[model samples]
Target chain A: MSAAAVLAVVVGAAAAKGELTGDPKAGEAIYARCFACHALAYNRTGPKHCGLLGRRAGSVAGFEYSAAMKRANWVWNRQTLDRFLADPLKAVPGTTMGYAGVKDRQERADLIAYIEQAGRSEVCRAR
Target chain B: MSSRIQSPDASLSLASDAPNLETRRSFLGKSGLVLSGAAVALLAGRDVLAKGNRPAGSDVNVLNSALGAELEAIAAYQVGAESGLLQKPVLNLAVTFQGHHKEHADVLTKTIIKLGGQPVSAKEKYTFPVETLKTQSDVLRFAAMLEKGAVSAYLGAVPVFENRDLAKAAASILGDEAMHWAILRNALGDAPVPAAFMS
Candidate 1:
């Protein structure tokens, strides 16, 4: 089989397992891909996610906001987040999220799950 | 383009997916990812023994993710080494770079334990591109991309650490990865330093 095929199968299998709410722990692992830009409570290259649930996109304090992010009107929630993550470049042109967004729905689901939990963690609260 | 290159880590696999290994390694080998060894150990779902410690703040998560990237970098270098696409001179350089990644992984793993965090053990297989490499230049380009990503990833990692010590280490490694990226770019006849600032 092709490498793309293998990836599709592997990724598809991973997503299929998530079902609906997705797996936060598994999503945490997927969040590794985001570590290059984001952190749980504080901002890095990207804005922090400590209170990302209802937070406006690109509104984190202190972190310099990308013009695109700052201009975005969308709020972060499951539906909007799913669309953004499905394709950050398309969802928000001029966005610097960089990587091809997580292609697998389940992976995204899981990742969002973890981000939500971490956003609510003591560390985030402390921040 | 050494499409005939072989994977170095086929022998290191603990899994039964011999066929999967061939196709997967073949793709990486040809596409310039040339990964093996450490990838097999983790991607095959075997435990690598992170050992326990008194975990601290979110630093553990950050460190484990950083470690994961290092492991991928290590696999990429190994992929290049066993691919036979690299000439001895380039291969030696790649080996040196691989050693650096291994060192990074070691420190991250140990530090993760010291922070009371479990280091990442199992990894899902990466999606390496296929048949895109038709020359040594192709491999070099791919390797350079990975190095560049490593440099950028470290940029974020350095700040996320709660302990200033780990941040220092991350910054140090970031310099090394940047150096590697620059050298690879030079080898590709591109500007070693292509930008005024990374981000």
Candidate 2:
């Protein structure tokens, strides 16, 4: 094969592998869907969803949670959140979040990425 | 120029066979010509007609409606913040809700603009149910109702939006509203997921 053709093949492979470059802008738009239920700050609504990426489920302060959620024992890491968002009922049965999990893989990834980024901010961590 | 040819007046003879048939055929023929003439007129005035008859798609209408609701909610929160009826924690919650409402308004406005509709600006004056809200509990009650209505509207509109991205956006907002509802319910000392909401 020619050198140019070989280089093109290598670049194409890299591009395919990098297809999931989650756009935070697009992710921010996607996060609007999440704002209905979870606040990025701590306070009165359900649980404060700030800093949720590495935090365990049902661990936010000042929110009274269901017994099932409290005992679920799962953390909100990317993989775990992906699985839970894919199938919330299946991921942790008896939990109260009634959303039919996001079926689109790209949307789930974008949502997770946004949450992770938002969770890292000082406002998110203040609570 | 070529000689102008006169078409046969078929209706004259046809009128004798069946009186109504002649009327029907004549009506249809004349109507067809009128319609054709109107089409020509429209084509000539295409820009004017296009400006007048914007596509009234349901998604666009719903987004506009949602934007209006968000504006109302924002106004409500601002009032609640200034009323001094709420303590520090409740006041902070109202601020949070106001921020979310602003976000919702911004997104819905963008959606309307994207779909070729003009977004309505948020008004400073709002008519809220807070006239009767004399205490912190009363304020919380009103907030709960507002959040519940927002959740219902988002959920109801989700199915009507044909665009997958718009539907996703609606669902995202619906989830947040649901969370807000839960929080408000908790504040009101009710169950997070009320029986009515679950059903």
Best lDDT goes to which candidate? 1
* Per-residue accuracy of model 2 over B9-50 as CA lDDT, tens digit each: 212221123454446548977887433222322232333234
Evaluate fnat for each of the predicted models and list the values in order.
0.03, 0.00
Chain B TM-score (model 1 vs. true structure): 0.70
**Candidate 1 lDDT by residue in tens digits, B74-136:** 666666666668785676677767766776777677666655567764233432332665577
Best by DockQ: 1
lDDT against true structure, model 1: 0.65
Instruction: Kindly give the stretch of ten consecutive residues in candidate 2 chain B with the minimal lDDT sum.
Output: B1-10
Query: Candidate 1 DockQ category?
Result: incorrect
What lDDT does candidate 2 reach at residue A14?
44
The Cα error of candidate 1 at residue A12, in Å, is 37
Off by over 4 Å in 2: A1-127, B1-56, B196-199
